[model samples]
Target: METSRKPVLYSYFRSSCSWRVRIALALKGVAYDQAPVNLVKDGGQQLSSEFQSVNPMQQVPALKIDGITLSQSLAIIEYLEETRPDPRILPQDPKKRAQVRMISDHIASGIQPLQNLAVLQQMGEKKMEWAQRCISRGFKALEQTLQETAGRYCVGDEVSMADLCLVPQVYNAERYKVDLAPYPTIRRINKALLELEEFKTSHPSRQPDTPPELKA
Candidate 1:
């Protein structure tokens, strides 16, 4: 972990989960090289034999760091936190840290899976409605949770892992055409998060693999 070598991240731009890791890396000031794994083209490059060898789950947002390949965005982030603690993304206070994990889990597990690519494709004709409804339900709960937990960020005055998780989900919600007016707290938090350089730089449109037309 103390080498001069930069980590390599295999990721896709539109993937919220991938975005989460990207934000974490940026916030930690961990320089990385991106290996764009286009999830859409060629029936998902992530599913290819080579990529699957790197990740049996066949997922993007896999990080090659310190001679280890780590999969799953949140897990990769936790590993980063363990190795690179400066400017920590998790909170120092025990209770606030729990709250951060709570909010992060709610979105990461509760909300994300219901709207992931497989689910969307399975929905077929009802995909739009399914995605919109799923996002609204998740956002409603998230809005309520943040009202009690938020100040400047998801857990408190300082940005935390929860904020990293929230930003990408909000992006996915917007892409799925969910109405944001129902969740003002989420919108406010997202707007503030977007203003920060790390979040802005880690944005999907800014990624190396982002489709040209989708680039902002």
Candidate 2:
């Protein structure tokens, strides 16, 4: 069924939201073509009118599948899961599904939204130290929660949506020079996820959109 259709992902290299969708797609063993939207250069290609037609919000990580264009990383991920369920990114049990959703939301809602590149750029341009401080504060709370919930992965031994959320957030924290030593659970889980082929392959460095200077 999937072989007949082409799935094109419109994504940015450094956008953590795009990273999430990339990791989810890789885990599900889904094949897709990537259309890179360089976020840093030329004032962000995402803001262009051409990209805006695909996603009115002008956000990275929009998915075009079977002639349908969709925005929002989580929404796109859910759509992929519903349409292709072979390698389930979500748990089948109701309780486990809720747990995964809760973990994804904690980072998606509580952390990533505030610390996004655009938000941080605004803080820097405005010389707002308080915004940066708030990110650190949020990380501390997340670290504590991760410690309580982690066991091989964020929610359990199974690699669910939580692990997907954790890896990118950890990467962002490291980029910000945030002290990750305080979050041992996050550190451990992230390390484990990195060792896996799916997580490693979908990393920003591996993305075609990633700049040559940043690739390692």
Question: Quick one: best TM-score, which candidate?
Answer: 1
- Residue 60 CA displacement from its true place in model 1, Å: 1.2
lDDT of 2 at 113: 85
Q: What are the models' TM-scores?
A: 0.97, 0.91
Candidate 2: C-alpha lDDT? 0.81
lDDT of residue 59 for candidate 1: 86
Q: Write the per-residue lDDT of candidate 1 for residues 26-91, one digit (tens) a residue.
A: 988888999999998998898899999999999888999998899988889889898999899888
TM-score of 1: 0.97
Candidate models: Cα lDDT each: 0.90, 0.81
Where is the poorest 10-residue window by lDDT in model 2? 126-135
Clashes in each model (backbone N, CA, C under 3 Å)?
0, 0
